[model samples]
Target: MESKKKIMSEKLPITEVNPINSRYYDYAHFTYPWHFHSQYEIIWVKESTGLCFAGDCIERFGPGTLIL
Candidate 1:
């Protein structure tokens, strides 16, 4: 129930000077909680293995996985 009530609204660091905001994350594990953003998100897994949750859809993802 916390995930349903505590959905975070993320404000991406995008500016007029830089339209697109890109970042590379190399972490031991995913620490971010359930969240949503106004802007579209594209996640590319270069090397990793985990589950991806989008709405009610849940699936396993591995290296070279691209989620749009």
Candidate 2:
């Protein structure tokens, strides 16, 4: 059997007036698949606990956890 890996390319909703894209999510769990973006990204978790996977690194994150 052949295994296939897929990653999604995400485009940020940025504009001239607002060059930065920010969001606040309150969900039971993350539903997005593996993805990548051209622009720099930052994730700040205000509340929740989960495992964060970046590249080949995996770490546990919770409230006040910031990733850049």
Candidate 3:
């Protein structure tokens, strides 16, 4: 959110890099704490799985999943 800020790295395969909106890149994993923002968010997960927390919605997600 807030203009889509992404923290990126390259320790792993680029495809492994979680996507955030129109901007795309090849990088590593990312993490975000429980929080909120004003902008819209788009996320894609590939080759990985984890729990997602969005505005009190808590659930487990797997690869090839998209969240917004």
Candidate 4:
């Protein structure tokens, strides 16, 4: 079997959290598909709203919530 590789992003500073992560999607929303990774994630939304899916739970989140 051939080896497959997953794309990885560089470490970002604390000030550039939202825009850096939000760039995953474009105006049409036909960006990268749903996927999971081994690393644990924590997202912070500043002046924005969107949907979140973690494991089996799905819901809308905003600027003050923390997801695991």
Please report the TM-score between candidate 1 and the true structure: 0.77
Candidate 1 per-residue lDDT, tens place, 1-68, comes to: 35445889999988888779988888888887889987878989888898999767899999999987
Poorest 10 consecutive residues by lDDT, candidate 3:
7-16
Query: What's the C-alpha lDDT at position 48 in model 3?
Result: 72
Q: After superposition, how far is residue 53 of candidate 2 from its true place, in Å?
A: 0.9
lDDT pick, better of 3 and 4 = 3
- Taking all chains together, the TM-score of candidate 4 against the true structure is 0.46
**Residue-level lDDT tens digits of model 2 in 14-61:** 778989987777777887789987787788888889999976789999
lDDT of 4: 0.58
By lDDT, rank the candidates, best first.
1, 2, 3, 4
Name the candidate, 1 or 3, with the larger TM-score value.
1
lDDT of 4 by residue, 1-68 (tens): 99876655545433434433333322333244456765456655454567887778998987687777
- Return the TM-score for each candidate structure: 0.77, 0.74, 0.53, 0.46
In order, what lDDT does every prediction score?
0.86, 0.86, 0.63, 0.58
Candidate 1 CA-lDDT value = 0.86
Q: What is the lDDT of residue 68 in candidate 2?
A: 75
Roughly what TM-score does model 2 have, to 2 decimal places? 0.74
> After superposing candidate 1, which stretches have Cα over 4 Å from the reference?
1-5, 15-17
> In order, how many clashes per candidate?
0, 0, 0, 0
Tens digit of per-residue lDDT, candidate 3, span 23-49: 565556554434565556778887677
The lDDT of model 2 is 0.86
